[model samples]
Target: MTGDERTTTVGQLPTPDRDRARLPATLTRVVWLLWALSLVVLGLRWWRGEGWELAGVVAVDGLTVVLWAAVTFFGGIVHSYARRYMAGSETIDRFFGRVFAFTLVVLVLVAAESLVLFWLAWLAMGLLMADLIGHVEGWPQARAAGALARRHFLASSALLGVALATLWWETGATTVSGVAATVDGASPLVVLVAAGALVVAAMVQSALLPFHTWLLSSMTAPTPASALMHAGFVNAGGILLVRFAPVVTVEPAVMLAVVLVGAASALGGKLLKTVQTDIKGTLGCSTVGQMGFMLMQAGLGFFAAAITHLILHGFYKAYQFLSSGSRVEHTAPNGTSDGGTTGPVGGAVVVLTAIAGGALFAALTGKGTALDTGLLLAGLVVLTVMHAAREVVRQSDVPAAVRYGAVPLVALPAIAVYATVYGAIEGLLVGLPAVDEHAALTPVHALVGVAFLLTYLAVDTGVYRRSRRLYVALLNAGQPARETLLTDTEDYNEY
Candidate 1:
């Protein structure tokens, strides 16, 4: 069979011959049209140099337009892909409806001028997602996943409501922009409490640590839903932080808490990803790790970098999920490998090259305050170390010298793209409220950096690989429901 035929046949359930596949195609076209219209509207608004503002209750700026554009762009792509991938499914129309609705809700949330609208949109999105997750009503796993997601989302919404209420009570600002503008004048105690609540809300929404099971369980949903959820909704937490950057950046305690939680989630998610046996599970774990990284960027006061990362990762993950069915066709038919390994010396060379490339890019950007600079430098070191390790694993057969040379060639271009995107976002958000003061890096930041480096080294060096028990535990840490979800029972019993 041809590659396309093979992909279409794999893991696909048999559908009735009379299935109305054209419904999904039509839905896809509608979604694309809506996306195009949004672009036109946003562009005209930008051209006129006027944003919609409703008595400090609602506002839209360049940043809002940019974020809305991204959501629509990705949402359209996913809709188009799903039109084919889910063509024969019985509930294709329902799937398309939910996806389109969720996309619209996200657009509203991103452009919401007031805190009340943003919170309502946030809650609505979560409920819509849960409905989508339970689209296959007869499937027990889908029901369980939906239930888990609803519970977490409810808690997240409550926390976010409290945070918003506090901001309003203290600043008498009903709009996000208004709240941000008045944050500096609020009492320190009020700011800290509100920021803490917001961070916790973000953590829950992003599925950090204890709240991550929903993401994994959610793989039981249709592929299109999974793609959209991970690619878009999962990053809402980062968006939340960026939206409230003025407050989050000023509260050092809140920032420290964010960094700590983000670091833990990143490490745990990465470790879990290594042990996943299924593609969806692996992708789910990866989303958690990426969310953690995004939150860490926000914690370090790299608001622009966090936004850039969110946008890029959304596109990358959407592609990953939509094309996941082609994995079988792309794999080596014989399943054999050269089994080459990069020794310590080669690994060191790759790491050094990556670090140098990252440092050079950081210097070129020349943005951020001194504290931001230090935090960026520290983050770059960790990023490069991880990047080099990945490169080493992928190209284990290459000579050390050639690999070392290639590392810069690859790393530098990626860094450049990141910096360019970050700069653009910074420019767009320049008029928005942001913390401008630079504070010296505290010992906690230093310790977090050290811990990340050491953990990476240990994982790369096979410390966990050497311990079978540890490896197994890490692999199954948050996967207790995996067996229940994957089992092939025909009964409609709820899990």
Candidate 2:
């Protein structure tokens, strides 16, 4: 039942006291009503001969409303269904409530992105949404949960809204050049203003250093909230950076500055991840690292590469957070599990489909950008394989279906497809006469990749050499891995 442990009995989280949990219910209804109204407006606009393209976009925007409804309604329903099973457990109720709150925030975001122009407003509104939901669900533990939610809501919303608005207003004034920026012939003042806005945004999102403290502190919230932060909110830093790329991309110096900052965050996350003892802290550091990669790709003018990495890594990390408790159990009980029903064959099918889709897209685009795409994809494959290998070694008792076959089976093919495509693209790009930026991928690039790979390999080997008990201890140590500090909330007893 504790926050630190990884196992739970059947029907652990469920809904109860619905009549008393009126605030979340009221908020849910309000959101649904807004969604319904938005749909009707979009429908009427389409009927009035707004361009079909615009209408289509409206429908896509409706997706956010639907996502919100699904998460909230279904979570509530699930709680109701399990009420009897969870008869007396406020812990489980609060847990599900936190999840519902996180889902509410995500829905607001995706919905806002669909509308494009309303993003600042969405960011603003989403701040209070989680706290309101937490207040409702955490009725039993109302004081502590509500206090945390309020602080989180106020701080995040204020920072996000102000930073984004500042960027939009200042950057809105100028024209730039290059792949990322649209404004051209920007003045020094403009550049300085834009840079200031970005630094503020970076600070707000906890890009690195000081901003990172918020993320670590958020671990005190519910498990699902922790998962949401690691998987989505934390990842927003890289996404926001890319979103602002238009302003930052003009100056090579600025681009390098952004990349250097991203590189630092990545290295910090990696080093800290090595020492993390708590599961949430481990995941949090990993997220910081992933965001760093996204920012790096954006700085490289490989926008699509960054998006690809973000989508794939975000889903997997989220799944990991949601499934952490399941992992401790070591076996599927009943039919309920956090992982998808996808068995080994299903996993293979998913991987193959992804590869095939990538090939198809490359063929269609045929615009020579595929080479960058292929390299990014190849790097993803390398990272994925290494991660699976690490897990296989750490959790040696995973299901035979996954442990022996699925991991290697899915990973090896992905690696092969990515490597082959990357190598072919590189050879073509390099061997072709009169290609621009040919010197970009010189021996230096190769040396850097090799050096990074070797460093990671050494770290992996060291972990493998240690006994499981020692490995577990190292994993538990978290950020200050070398120094074993004791915290009452952390579960040192289990390890």
Give the Å shift of residue 26 in candidate 2.
Answer: 8.0
TM-score per model over all chains: 0.87, 0.57
Model 1 lDDT, full chain set: 0.77
lDDT values of the candidates?
0.77, 0.47
Report the lDDT tens digits of candidate 2 across residue range 326-351.
65645446865223234455445445
Candidate 1, residues 319-425: lDDT per residue as tens digits? 89888877644554586643456667766766676666656566756642245445544465446555555655457567667766666676677777777877767
Backbone collisions counted per model: 2, 14
Against the true structure, candidate 1 reaches a TM-score of 0.87
lDDT of 2 at 72: 45
